[model samples]
Target chain A: MTSKQKFLYFIYLHRTGLSVTGLSLALLLFPLIEDNPYTLGLTNLIAINALVVLGLNLFIGYAGQISLGHAAFFGMGAYGSAIATVTLGMPPWLAMVIVAILVALVALLIAVPILRLSGHYLAMATLGLNFVMYTVLLQWDEVTGGPSGFSGIPYLSIGDVQFDDEFRLHYLLWSFVMVSLMLCLNLVRSGVGRGLSAVAGDEVAAQALGVNTRNAKIKVFILSAVLASLAGSLFAHCYSFVSPDSFGIFTSTDMVIMVVVGGMGSIWGSLFGAALITLLPEWVDMFETYKDFVHGGILVLVLMFLPQGLVTGLIDTIKIKLALRRRKNVAS
Target chain B: MLRLENVSKNFGGLPALSEVTFTVPKGQLTALIGPNGAGKSTLINCMTGVIEPSSGQIFFQQQQIASLPAYKISRLGISRTFQNLKIFPRLTVLENILTGLTSEGGDSMLMAMLRLPYLRHRERSLKLRALEALDRFGLADKANWPAEVLAYGDKKRVELARATVGKPQLILLDEPVAGLNAEETATVAEQLRLLRSAGHTMLLVEHDMDLVMEIADQVVVLDSGKCIATGTPDEVRCNPLVLEAYLGRMGATA
Candidate 1:
């Protein structure tokens, strides 16, 4: 093979490594190329959503569990950090860590009962969880600021560096996404990942093959919730505010749509889905007013045409086309 | 290697398996033969901890395992294949085999994420073993293909490869070659002989009488949820109860 061909072959062999390297380079250079704060802010939001989607994909796509209430976990993270840093005077970094742990514990507590359910029932239970959380954020006026939403949250900073602007925060948030993407990619190739895939494919067969389906589901659920919580914290800090409106049932549904549109079992698909959905409103003026209609339309279209999710389906099509072309060349 | 005593399973008021007892000796191929609805599947399910027997004791290597969950029983070196194929359709064939290896020496989800050198080494070794398993079943070339795309006979071979990849103490094959064509059946029969000669204890539930008669060291015949006969193949073949309930007048004419 020529050098270019050899390089492509290497990428095919080590796709995860290529993804990590490519993402790192993009995150580092994208801000330099586009020095617009408006674009930077949207990209930062994409990174935050991508973080949550990566973890959610592990639960939904790999472990075969459903959680439609991730918005609640995201809310818990944001509010948890907001309360700790603003009201209780805790450090922002410390607050983020503590809230993430608390969210994980909460997920573990409810996972046993909620994950016992599958199909539409599981989806409904999680949706109900999002409703309960939204209600609490609205009704608990004493702490959460009620309908007005929580504000005055400060920016996150390291020892000497502060992520005070969109440009600076892009690095902070995308770094989280990059690391999480790497870990998730590593996980899906691991034995535990195989176990998750087994459960997703056939839970009974997975059990027979010695995969602890129940435990695997619960672990991935907690992991997914914790990531959503972390992303929520980052979201709160980036905007310097917390709001019930952002963590409603609609956001949860939108997140699920992102996973479905990205491709269920593909790790890279998570980032693709998050970016596409996050940018949709910016690209189309009609998106906000018809958000539900557009989201539903995209979902229906994707399901009908690309049932395996956009990225995976596209890749499969390209592969088939390439193979057919190669066969024709050999025949001639 | 496995012993079931007075194992009876009831669904609602009806009994599927009643007072069924048999022993699968170590390093022996035990063919479980019976007519339709004779409770052979139920007996396999009970032994593998898929379902709880209403009243019975199941011992594996002299330890009571009747109440253990399927995964725990699998961890105890017992593995099984489903009567209907349960291949992980989306996973690659190699990954399907790797799933079987996870019951032993597998890392936790957290440990896997860390990607430590030792864990990477372990993963590489495990992949090698999975590839070797695929080679054994003539599926090494298709290791990267999604299992759902494989032909029916190839899917069955994948299931067999998955079951044996873990090197379990006892393998309960629900119906290894049930729907296979003659060529596939002969290939599977050869694989069984290879597994047997390698000293793996197997409890095969199959309807292919010739495969069983050729490879089985012992045969246990069940009729209507009861053990009708158990002995060497020659002995079970001559038993009038087995001939009547399963082998029928065909064996008598032969």
Candidate 2:
């Protein structure tokens, strides 16, 4: 492949590489180890969360829409998958498909009204929606198990093959994460990406240029919600149990922090953000008491000194300095 | 051809455009001239469907279009530049012009998403077209530069390049030379004449009377949402009603 093609291929493999390499290294180093299941499962969970965050970044980072209630959509997916399996007696694989579609439809319904709002109004409206969803999950005991959440969720399987163990489920989740990340990268680099940027830059200019800005925003919002829901479903089946706490405002905040700390509008940034935020707490176990304070301080530093987020800001500064040096050389 | 009939716009109780009517012929440059608060911008906004008139009908190509959205109006072979420069700042100069090619089949969201062969071919052709448009406005060298980095006069020209890139049947230029220097104004006038010669119809709203007189085939004078005079530039310049409207209130010479 040409250098450009090689570069793009490298970017595509970067996220999936981390998961595969990490898993392989762990296996090779600790061939006789038996107590590593928790760490392996948690790593898979972080990768899955990164997939969902990638979707959110496409909608919020590229499309410039605020969605604080993405967790509600995530909850819907988990519940939808569980009910499809338990109530309808469907296969877990089929349940996932049904749940994804159901969540997409729900997102469409919610986006139609909420996407009309802009800025802080839209943020507050989505926040209110998450609160409403929490109330419903708390009161709806028949299906959601009220505060206890759902249990006995079936294992995901393809035909005769079942992902029943942590090792098998890690591969499955990583495969989906790779696919999701690739889809997101393609989306943001396409014409829709330009349309989203135009909408974010200036709505009136976008409209005058014949872009259906409202429709574009709503579509991205729904797409993001659907992806989040898919991740939630996988997460539920991974543990064979899911509670209201699994998909709540705190979950949404975690995703937001991932997107923000990594970089707002970059796909790779989302992955970077997810990995760091997810793995940092585990690695910093000694400083457990000051975890929140440290994370908050990192956020403040990123906002104050690197407002464009880590990756983009660094790239821009390098480009600027290089251009200046070239100009100076030419002049001299 | 375009026609506006009995257009009336009211902001609360105050009238912005009241019963304004005019017809612009095909392949002719028509100038809309008026003093401040004379409803010139309001009339352009009404025609472009930016802000709907309180009551009115706008016809373009013998079809009613006042109720259509601004983007739809643009897609129907009518493009316009803003009084305030509205070029996409972060985009390059070429991309700004490419944005104007909205009706082209190659740049659809689906094609862009899939990155189809046809989309790549169209994008290449669009770059060529954008270059031609920029060259016409003497901005070919700056095609790769971010639009935010351009000077004010160059930015105005970029906006014009963007508006005219679609090869629209009619282009509404709002104050195309409002803040331009003499040389820039002359360049814009020359570009407009070239556009006219190339069979593009233009409706210009300009405060530069000299530039208007140099190129206008017909001049329509508006005062407080009413047409004061409609004639050739020379004839309108000599009309007593236009003189009264311009000098009677301001105590200045025409």
Candidate 3:
């Protein structure tokens, strides 16, 4: 192939790697520019939540599956690690790996029948699942501290290189964040991604296109659950605490809202969404009593104006305008 | 290459098709013509496994496929276009065709995440094939455009490209030119003829009698899901039973 053709092919393979690179660069640079412990801690939390939201996006955003009980997977990961370490006496890192696998298997089992549902039925199914997970976490206090929450979780360390410092933790979280983003980006343009998009657009038509719609939905759901599990493990380690309240139906709904406000189906858009939803509350703290009102108003306005979330809507606008300009140029 | 035996479909105690049997010969173009509610779409659905027949067997390449789902049937070298456009509206035109290409490594997330050489190799080959399909449909320049923005006729062409991009053993076209002008219909007809000449077996469910007669080597007529007539275009054209079924609207509609 000629140089131009080779360049085009590269883009066809990656669908433009510029955004992924930009995200990596900004994530790496954010802490260096700030350096404060509070900012770093907040950054780590954003990364953690973004990680969970990333998993949610895989199901809700990319594959067009509705999940309202993602926090159950998140909670399971947290509690899964706690039980593995405190009860089983396994190492922290080993607990993390095992929890992820366990959660994925559970998700696969749960998804088989649930994935068969469409539209509101699927949403309701997931919503009920969250309640079941939360109830188990509360009543089964023998391991989960009886809804009061669990503490004394061991800090994660890798020999001499400990993730103890706030700055190190921020780096650690972003490291996983960047890797997850890379994997997601690659998957989005891959066959699985297109298949998910196809399933989302029209299940019947996607099936007609030779896409196994239910199987595709189940695979993506398992992946997102695994991702949420990983994030849950990290969340427990980050605070050195675990709780049922942290992984409840409300959090599950919040994750869905983040996926929507971030831009459904856009990985880059989710990052912006995670940052906005996480930081926006802090930014509005001055209102104290009026915070909820202000925060909700701002979100409503953003949706009313941008509609498709900020990043995706902006990108689409630019693309449409560019196309129109090209046509105008040709005509004039 | 495709055969249906004793096919019957009933929706909630109402029979849509009953004991419909037909054969589409290998390496030839066959047109299925019927009036409104003649169960043409239902038959297409049965042939492509979109909906299971109430009773009967569908054979493709001499294998029973009536039990298979739509996706499995397509993977087994049977593909179809919808009476209404079913193109992935948000996807780029090229992506729509690429979705049908069925590259091996892409089906697995790990292979995709690692960007394995084999997956890359498949993508490169698939991209070229998709671009070639776009070119054949006169859609090369519009390959990057979202399919929803294409003109109606162009969307039909895109659907055709998507169906045949997999190089299936049989292509099922349901109302391929229902909403197109004469010029657009001519363009699509020419494209179908090209596929037929290229040795691709096609089963077309269409309404335009003129185009059907012009292109189909043989024609099958259905009324309320029963095979009313099956013969060459000339033979079916002169059949008194076929004319009477038209209910006096026959004229040039034949």
Candidate 4:
């Protein structure tokens, strides 16, 4: 195949089957070695969280917007779905759908005002909004169950199939994660992605080209929020409980770090970041007492040496050096 | 055709463009020439709806367009290039031009969200058009190269390619050849001549006297935010008022 065709083929395979194969391989190996469901359950949670991070990558990395309150939107989706299922006695699948739509609407409402401001001001606005959301989630006792959090959330099911067991939920979460990643990949490859890149590169230029910069920002923000909410709902159903801590400031920061460390503007990088961030704590648990120190040290090193994030920085440096060598050879 | 009547702009009591009036005829290249701070850019801004005039009317093709936004004005068959190069740095040369082609004002939100096949087809056609634009500017070979890596002259050429890719009826070129070497300047001038031959109407704001004299069918000289002279390039070049505005007392004698 020609190089271009080869590249496209690689992208196609990576988009469609790579995740499926990875999940299948993990499942095949998972049962033979381990019987513990807790480890598998946590791993599944990480995979779900990674999908949410992938969505945020589209907004934060590709669109170049700061979102410190992403977890709040995720929390909203979780709680929205939980409330719909428990309080309102709706079916789980229908409740999830309603929760996604409501989360997107809330995101739109928030974006209308916040998108007008950019940079640090935008960051602060999102951070403050997240804090307010956390307080509301805590104080709204009757519906949300207050600080104790919501309980008895129904397990997720579609038709006759139930995802109450750890393995079942793992496969289901993986399915959604793959779908979200594929959607994100396609979105970035489209004209909408080009517009977002233009806005990120230079807002004024994008405006001069007749791009509605404000509207684009709002749309992407809402899309990202909806995805986060979907993950939140899934998480709530998986655990059969919902809590304020799951959608707190720390959770938001964790998502941001995942996207940044993996690579900004790259969906796959966000996945890699999510996987590493999620799995590293488990590996460090062997140290037990020094787990936090090891995690903190890794973050510091990653930030200090690879500020553009790990994946992109390495790729750029290698490309530059190769380009320089090619130019020298041409001159000779 | 474009006309600006009684256009006035104020910055908290200081006048930037006060009662400025002018008309640019259809199918001709008109030069807006002025010394530093003569409100040349401000006039362009007002005409393009980047700044709202305090009291004035703008007519493009005899239609009132004074209150419209910049993008809306662009969509209505008017496009512009900036004084500072504004090419998307990370995008490829062809992609930059494709942006101009795909930037119609009417794509629906549903279409954008769904990634409709028709939009995809339009995008493919735009890419082909972008390639043709690159070829016209002698940049077809560099179509895949990142815009940021191009030299300043090539970047300006790419910028022009982007602006004109939409095939707009009227194009506003703000100092198109600024900061170019003589060779690159000649290339740009040749391209402008080619554009003019293709029956494109151009309103150029340029400081390159030789280029302006060579390409401009008509010249409008502005002094202190008002048009001081309007005539053919040679007529304006000889007019005492134009000379005085450009060089003061010595200009008349010279």
Question: How does model 4 do on interface RMSD, in angstroms?
Answer: 2.8
DockQ (0 to 1) for model 4: 0.40
Clashing pairs in 1: none
lDDT accuracy of residue A258 in candidate 3: 78
**What TM value does the first chain of each candidate achieve?**
0.94, 0.86, 0.89, 0.89
Give the CA lDDT, 0 to 100, for residue A58 in model 3.
79
Model 1 Cα shift for residue A139 (angstroms): 0.7
Ranking by TM-score: 1, 3, 4, 2
Provide the overall lDDT of each model, using Cα atoms, as 2-decimal numbers: 0.89, 0.81, 0.84, 0.82
Best by TM-score: 1
Best by the DockQ measure: 3
lDDT of 4 at B12: 88
lDDT of 2 by residue, B1-254 (tens): 99989999999999988888889999999999998999999999888878889998999999998888877887788888888988876566777777777556334444565666766676678778989999988888778666766779989999899889888999999999988899999988998999999999999999888999899999999998888888999899888998888735544743
Q: What stretches of model 4 exceed 4 Å from their correct place? A: A1-43, A286-308, A319-332, B104-106, B247-254
- Order of the predicted models by lDDT, top scorer first: 1, 3, 4, 2
Candidate achieving higher TM-score, 1 or 3 = 1
Residue pairs whose backbone atoms clash in candidate 3: A141-A146
Give the per-residue Cα lDDT of candidate 2 at A311.
74
Cα RMSD to the true fold for all candidates: 2.3, 4.6, 2.6, 3.4
List runs of model 2 lying over 4 Å from the truth.
Answer: A1-43, A165-167, A286-301, A304-307, A316-332, B103-112, B138-141, B247-254
In model 1, the Cα lDDT at residue B10 comes to 95
